[model samples]
Target chain A: MTRVYLDNNATTIVDPKVYDVMSPFFCQMYGNPNSLHSFGSETHPALRTAMNQLYKGLNASDDDDIIVTSCATESNNWVLKAVYFDKILNGDKNHIIISEVEHPAIYSTCKWLETLGVKVTYLPVNHDGIVEAHTVKDFITDKTALVSIMWANNETGAIFPIKEIAQICKEKNVLFHTDGVQAVGKIKVDVQDVEVDFLSFSAHKFHGPKGVGGLYIKNSQELSALLHGGEHMGGRRSGTLNVAGIVGMGLAMELANDAIEYENKEVRRLRDKLEDALLQIPKTFVVTSRDKRTPNTMLISIKGVEGEAMLWDLNKAGIAASTGSACASEDLEANPVLMAVGADKELAHTAIRLSLSRFTTEDEIDYTIDVFKKAVIRLREISGSYAE
Target chain B: MAKNDLIGGSIWEEYSNKVAELMNNPKHRGRFTQEEADSKGFKLIVADFGAESCGDAVRLYWLVNPNGDIIENAKYESFGCGTAIASSDMMVELCIGKSVDEAVKITNLDVEMALRDSPDIPAVPPQKMHCSVMAYDVIKKAASLYKGVDMASFEQEIIVCECARVSLSTIKEVIRLNDLKTVEDITNYTKAGAFCKSCIKPGGHEDREYYLVDILRETREEMEKDKLLQNANTVFGGGTVAFNDMTIVQKIKAIESIIDENIRPMLVMDGGNIEILDVKDSGSHTDVYIRYLGACSGCASSSTGTLFAIENVLKAKLDNALRVFPV
Candidate 1:
């Protein structure tokens, strides 16, 4: 079967160049960075090289500390829990602000912090699913410890005004954090330009290996270590370094950043072609316009067709796609991101997301469009609501 | 890049061959209209049931033999996941050639088991188990509309797990028979407390009178007591005698019946009547939301005297889990 993967937002395949770079670190020079032996010191140059690549890719300065963690989930938990201990516990500030449509890494962590008496203000999104910078200014209070928001929504791919929000936080003297998991490699992510105190990103989203991600800490802020034992990552994070994953992530970051222009032009053109073709089907509407969302993403809802039903047909045709709703859960919840975008209950269930990467070709896009349109027609014919 | 390294897990792989087959080409996918039923001298019964949140709905069309109450033909139109399409197809297949009562007796587990590619395996993933449950609920909806009775009447036993439709008696019996000790064990055997888990204890989707925690505890104590008695006398009784015993659903039916017999007429005599909107399990209490019709809509005694009067009547006759509210 001709497999056409358009589910880039979920994760990505490792680039061949990235895989090649990561291979040598696995069997050879596979030493603990903490060890002082020759085996360990042999890996020091590679680690420094990888770290430098990450800093340059993110446009983070030398003064900023970039700590490599397992994934963005850890980066999120470390930042939030660290704030809870540093400020919230000392009664310096007990309130935090975050956009309601944050990924579960940020959303669920805030929910857990709520049990610890940390007051969380989940800033509501507009109909466009964008958290307005002015609204962030309105919700900020004297006791506000941090304001964290997503750079781009995972479902709709709606890019938020992260730089504007960061500026507001700076003026208010409050720290700013952005979950840059979807934004870093997908878009132009400059920690200097955005002026975000903490930015979390993952490697696998940009065709790097999994189990490796990084946190960009501006000025190496006073935050508690999430893991305590080894003095690795300058004691900010404690664990034996995943040498291969780090190497792969660094190269992937560089490659992904280099393809930002190609992604904006070529990938976006393919994405728009797929989106426009899908719109030709009846009762189909895009969640965000091409200009509003990321270049390589298209979230559309087909009237009266359940998301997973459409996915099944697409899957059988060897086209990979994703839905906004939790299709796997028994308690079927409408996609909160879609819901925030002012989609109705039915539209929320019908939402399907197709995200492209630099590797996506025009031929694959055309094949997916053909398969998806047919799936919609087939599913709608059998749909109870649309049978008439 | 290696192809394996690029690709993530496929959600479609979680489904069985039977499920994918049915989902793609379901025999019972079409609907039966009244015209078709009239030509065959059968009653056309159409039923629709929507999930509270998932937006998944199933519409069942039944061509029933009015004389024998046998479903001459059954068809359905569903809007849900792939598993839902397969489960609905299997549900309608189970209904054909069976009496209405027999179809109503078909549980969600039966629907799931019927869709299995092999007898020992499951047709769908654990997450899609609720699709089978949706199939069962729609059956009750169709059966209730056809029988001209409350849908609650079709429910006989105390349903501990609404997701799996595993009843209290069945859970207890399974606990004893399989020597299931923990809540997880009961979940494995009967699938009770597996999904949603409102019936397992308080602070879930809903509160249940018979929680798995209390059921496991009480059934264990009774088992110990029965063991002592068995040691005293070297004879043992067979199991599953009262596994069919009705508890909460039977109590609900009883409560509704009492209100119909004792309370409705009295309120009607006062130029007013009451309609039961819903009876939900909230913690240890069963909250009944009602709407007073005619003169009882804004009656002076509706809050103080009449409300308590209805609550007292249901509580006095039925279980104390009943709490009456005029909505």
Candidate 2:
């Protein structure tokens, strides 16, 4: 059976072209970018090229404004904690604002900061999983240090109004950070257009190799480094540079940038076909709103059939899917993103996430719809809660 | 290639092969209809159990004989994850062809171990162990319905750890069999107080009735009592030793030897040491005054339970009328 991988939001397969661009850096051009030698000097140009590629992909103002990190998690951690640590030194700001449906990287870090006596306000989202700009505006105060929200939710795929929210933060003179890990490559992200002070994106979320991501700081905002070591990336983040992974990320961003139009058209059409077919099944409803979400994501719930059981059956039929955020699925807890959107416990437990990629084909979408319908029907047959 | 490879790779290796097989195609994963029970001449017993933490529920169906002992057929319906389905299926299979009494004896560990691919490794992840606990609870519910007893009767065995579903008897048995030294040892052996850690001691994230610290202390006391009883029997016969007939010096010597032999080591293990302060013969009863030093002075159990235990040991070894007083 041909495998249909629909869980692109978790991680995507590395593009073969990106792999080919990175293979040579593993052995031939291996050098520590910080070393003062020819081997290191040879790596500076490649690093500069990768930096320029990322700046273009993110539409950043300056190529030197981006700091390469391990992944989006490190970028998010650095942005949140660095701002709070700076506030501690200055002793002026004490409050931080964030959305409820943020990834654990932001949510959990803010929770940890709360134990250190830092005040935090978790702005609630509406039933469509959209965080309103007015909510962030209302929570702003003289002591508010920053406002951090996600560009697109990993679970429901609901896109927040980042541009409007960033404008609100600008009016209030508060820093704004958006976790653009899911939205940067799938959609067009121009840091100048949004005016977000900080933005984070991971390579692995697109078609790049893992362990390399970028953080865009507009106007070269100075924040304390989370990882301190030898002077690398102007000492903003320190460690040996992942040359091969960074090279792959640059090539992947270039490819993703070139394919954005085709993705918005072809990928969106295929996702809509899958979503429409899935909605036709009995007792199934799409969880996220159609207008304010990513083009490739469809979160749906088939009432009375458990999401995990459905995912297992889908896996058995050679289709890969998920029951919302993969990081939070290890436990039996219902999806908090679903609950934040006003879904009851039963609906949250029954929700499944299907995220497509630019590489997904029309035939794969059709096959996935057929297999998903059968799995839902079969699981409902054995389920005691499903009637008729 | 394996069919699991079609999904890209096999993360299912985290689960046992038997668990994966049973979770995919459960054998006893349907409702047992009353019509089917009527044709088989068996009374149907249906019991429902729900886990509030995870919102998972399981309904167990048992076809018991009219005399209400043997379970002839069993079926289940689970409204949860793959682990719940596999556990409920295994629970049904274990209940069939057994007497109601025998079926009720099956613990959650029994059901979990039966699903394990090997003896040492767990069949499912630690967080998923509660699925098996739900299955075990449904069995007791069904058994109560069959025998027309209160569901509370089935819960007579006290549960010390709710997270791991460890009973007080199981904790005590593990403590005695392996001579578990600390609360950490109990967690390593029986997995009690491993997750959430509210059951490890008091003042945790939640309240629990029986913490592992309390269980370990109580079990160690019981073991010590048994050892003292054995020592008393060997040193003194069935005949009562008359403490009044001896001089005060002899009484002090005998009490000192007993304390040195039996109780000192136990107290020292818990970072405490006890010293005998004074003893007075009050004609009708012997008054023994003792003082607790070191960590015991600040310990909460030192004043009440530890003092009572010391009195019991002295009473059992010497005269029944001897009293213990903390100075």
Error of 1 at B93 (Å): 1.1
Off by over 4 Å in 2: A325-332, B1-11, B51-53, B162-165, B169-185, B194-327
Candidate 1: DockQ?
0.24
All models, DockQ values?
0.24, 0.19
TM-score of chain B of each: 0.56, 0.55
- Where is model 2 chain B poorest over a 10-residue stretch in terms of lDDT? B232-241
The lDDT per prediction is: 0.85, 0.83
lDDT of each residue in B1-327, candidate 1, tens digit only: 278538644556767888889999988987887789999999999999874246578899999999899998999888888888898999999999999999999988898888878898877765567677779989999999999999988888778787778888899899899888899889888877775566777654334577899999999999988865654343113222121232445445556777898899999999999888877777677788889999999999999899999999887766666788888
Among these predictions, the greatest lDDT belongs to 1
- Compute the lDDT for candidate 2: 0.83
Local accuracy of candidate 2 as per-residue lDDT tens digits, A1-388? 8899999998999999999988888888898877889887788787788878998898887543888899999999999889989975466999999998899999999999999888999999887878988999999999999999999999878899999999999999999999999897788888988999999999999999889998889888778899999888888889888999888898899899998898788898898899989898877777667878888898897877777788888988889888752211333346677787776666767888899999898889888888888877667755677763
TM-score of chain A, every prediction, order shown: 0.98, 0.96
